[model samples]
Target: MSKIIQSFEAKELKKRPFIIKIADRLTSFFGSISFLILNLLFFVSWIIFNKFDQFPFPMLTMIVSLEAIFLTIIMLVSQQRQAHIATIREELDMQVNKYSEREITKVLNLLKIIAEKQDIKLDDKELDEMLNELELGYIERKLEEQLSEKQKLIIDLSPLNKS
Candidate 1:
């Protein structure tokens, strides 16, 4: 794994509340094949050892249902934490990308100036475009517009939309 990813995970882990940390550990354990095997064994033993007169073992069913409810809550908590971390990571990535874009544009502009001073004629229209600073909001709006148009097209073509 990347050092950056490792560092980010470690930092996030440190910032988590004790309860969240426990939930994360439980989530990890619950997701494992070992947990699945243990659960299967427990269920089998419960069925074989318990001499219940009732056909469908109401006690076992209740225990399983209760476990499911608690497990679902724990999984949701873990997922929420993961989503928060993902959002932070995405924001960090966007900031880095924006900074890089600005730096690259500045460098390109400087190179163009240097080429002009050295009397080296470079005729690249794409380089000229790259030299200009990007309007990120404009780009974002244009992207949104394109996606909206595509979505509308998909909705119109759907069989559910037909009479």
Candidate 2:
């Protein structure tokens, strides 16, 4: 992979606080199918070995609830860290894309100059049209507008809206 892509991943994984690293590992383990299997086995053993009523397992429920609370905290911490990393990656991508666009524009201008010097009579209508410079702000605004419109449409069509 390119250095830019490698940097995107490397920055997030490296220089992270110790607490965050632990939380990420815990989150990964807790979210896996292995965790589910373990929980199932624990529940089965508890039921088989214990004399408690099966209909309402108070002790098991309490244990599960406590586990869920801790798991949620760890997951949230990891998710927050991941969100931060994603934002950094997005900024990197935008910067790379903007640089690439500028380079492409330069190439196109050079090609146009070459064509002019060659006295090539190109009838392409697109060639006659001027190229629009990549505007990150404009694109972001347009995306936000479109997203808001879609959100509004979804809200209007939602069954919950009828009430």
Candidate 3:
């Protein structure tokens, strides 16, 4: 039930930027006079002769077709906007969480401190050699284990009932 409501709300929100504004402008442009005139014409036509059907299915189909075309354009624009926003967010996050060089330096520093605590004092040259060896070993092991478990991103939106 909640999912259904959310879907409806999302559709409505997307259409609001397109249809709702048009509706508002249309109402203000025509005023109540045009509305009453349209109804009066409809009422006279109805009294003159009966329509083909009671439910006006043909008119409903025409409306649905027109709306579908507009809705497609609106959905496309919304999707592109969403994708652009996502890319910007990803870039911002990358800048805020950059850690490649920092992480490498941290690992080296931690090893240096551990060596010092063990009373194994080393000169600058020796410390640098140790750091180099550790870095090489870490890189080798990490390269061997760098198999990403993440799946490729998919961008598919199709109805399940299609055959």
lDDT of 1 by residue, 11-100 (tens): 999999999999999999999999999999999999888887255889999999999999999999999999999998888888888999
> Between 1 and 2, whose lDDT is larger?
1
- Residues 32-135 of candidate 3 have per-residue lDDT tens digits of 68856975686566545656634555664565588668656655555655565567556655544445555766788897889899998767885586454334
* Clashes found in each candidate (C-alpha, N, C closer than 3 A): 0, 0, 0
List the lowest-lDDT window of 10 residues for candidate 1. Answer: 47-56
Better of 1 and 3 by lDDT: 1
Ordering by lDDT = 1, 2, 3
- CA lDDT of 84 in candidate 2? 87
For model 2, residues 1-163, the per-residue Cα lDDT tens digits are 2787788678769888999999988888888999999989998999888886465888888998999899889999999988988898888777887888888877877887888899986677675443456677888999999999999999999999998
lDDT (Cα atoms) of all candidates against the true structure: 0.93, 0.84, 0.58
Best-matching candidate per lDDT: 1
What RMSD, rounded to one decimal, does every model reach? 2.7, 2.2, 13.7
lDDT value for model 3: 0.58
Clashing pairs in 3: none
Which sections of candidate 3 miss by over 4 Å? 1-56, 100-104, 107-111, 114-163
Where does candidate 2 stray beyond 4 Å?
Answer: 52-55
**If both were scored by TM-score, which would come out higher, candidate 1 or candidate 3?**
1
- At residue 134, candidate 1 shows an lDDT of 95
